[model samples]
Target: MSAELPQPSTTSLADRVKNILIQPKDEWGRIDAEPATVAGIYKSYVVPLAAIGPVAGLIGMTVFGVRVFGLSYRPSFGATLSTAVAGYIAALIGVYVLAMILNALAPNFGGQKSEVQAMKVAAYSCTASWVAGIFQLIPALAWLAILGLYSLYLLWLGAPRLMRVPQDKAATYTIVTIVAAIVLFFLVGLVASSVTSMFMPRMPLPGGTLSVG
Candidate 1:
């Protein structure tokens, strides 16, 4: 009898998924649209950062007051857990929405345009932020650096994929983006803090009163 014919081996679906997860970008199809992409990133960053900083600061201050001042607790365990979960969901949605809107806006300019793929990239980066937030208790300094690096990595990965500018343009845009974002945030923080404080109406009881907030 002739030797049995060899059977074709097939990769299972799980194996396919694993391969996809671990797959690297195709070097041959690489894009160099950094300028437009980086500009897109900055556009997304500026608005959301402007919006969220105050909310974050308020949350931080509220948590600290609760712990340090030992304010009377009204919320039940269920309520607290629900609020935390809700907050996480809200943040994720907010991040995604911010990316989508700005990406839609990126293509209007001559120097910059949006790549649809960037939406996925931005989502992934924000997802990383969500995951890393779980480790916020990690030694404060180290955690800060880790969060920052993760953010930049996501931005780099997601932004350029959707941008279609030349290498020099991309690099320049990226640099300007970082620098301008830092400066912009400083100004926003200064302005937001001042404006919010002045207009937000301070609660009178400096020492102790019912804030419920």
Candidate 2:
């Protein structure tokens, strides 16, 4: 709640991380003061990792010894831990982008400032990414299951937040924001995946043409 920069709970690093990584939608203040902008709400959602990412990665690596040598809990069948991590990262980026879109478009549903509130929504989303990534180092279909659950849970949580619009337009905003955000996310994901697919390497055909077609 520091005015300098809207911060998550300052109790401790772990607690702050929890706020950023899980409970990201709420803010101590309804509006930001210093920036004299409405976007603080959205950007606050982005700021948590301003400190957590590097520090947490360092601590995690140090404590875990930079390798999962004996992680009995991790799945060990198909893809290596690295690939699972890669997939998780991909999903994270997709979700973050979706959150941004929601922040921008959903606010219309609520009549709130999209620019600032995006930060909170984005933070709230990391919860699913981390929860799935918990054992993502393992390679199985489990990641898919977790991802599905994460998507559902976000919508469930977000629906309420989206509805709390000013001027008493709560119900309309809730349905519009929640539904629009989800639709836009999938649309964005398809566009993104297609673009990435274009850059993917393709094997040569029997006649030696490299066409993905």
Best by lDDT: 2
**In model 1, where is the ten-residue run with the lowest total lDDT?**
27-36
Per-model TM-score versus the true fold: 0.42, 0.46
Cα lDDT of model 1 by residue, 40-84, tens digit: 433443234322323443343334323214333223333333434
Every candidate's CA RMSD: 12.2, 10.0
Residue 167 C-alpha lDDT in model 2: 46
Clashing pairs in 1: 33-165, 34-170, 35-170
lDDT by residue for model 2 (1-213), tens: 755854443344355445433554442132222232334422443334332322333233323322223332211212123332343344546545655655666567554555444544444444444444344222332234256346445544553454245645555655565566567557744764454333332322132122111
Cα-lDDT of candidate 1: 0.39
All candidates' lDDT scores? 0.39, 0.42
Q: What's the CA RMSD of model 1 in angstroms?
A: 12.2
- Scanning candidate 2 in windows of ten residues, the lowest lDDT window is 204-213
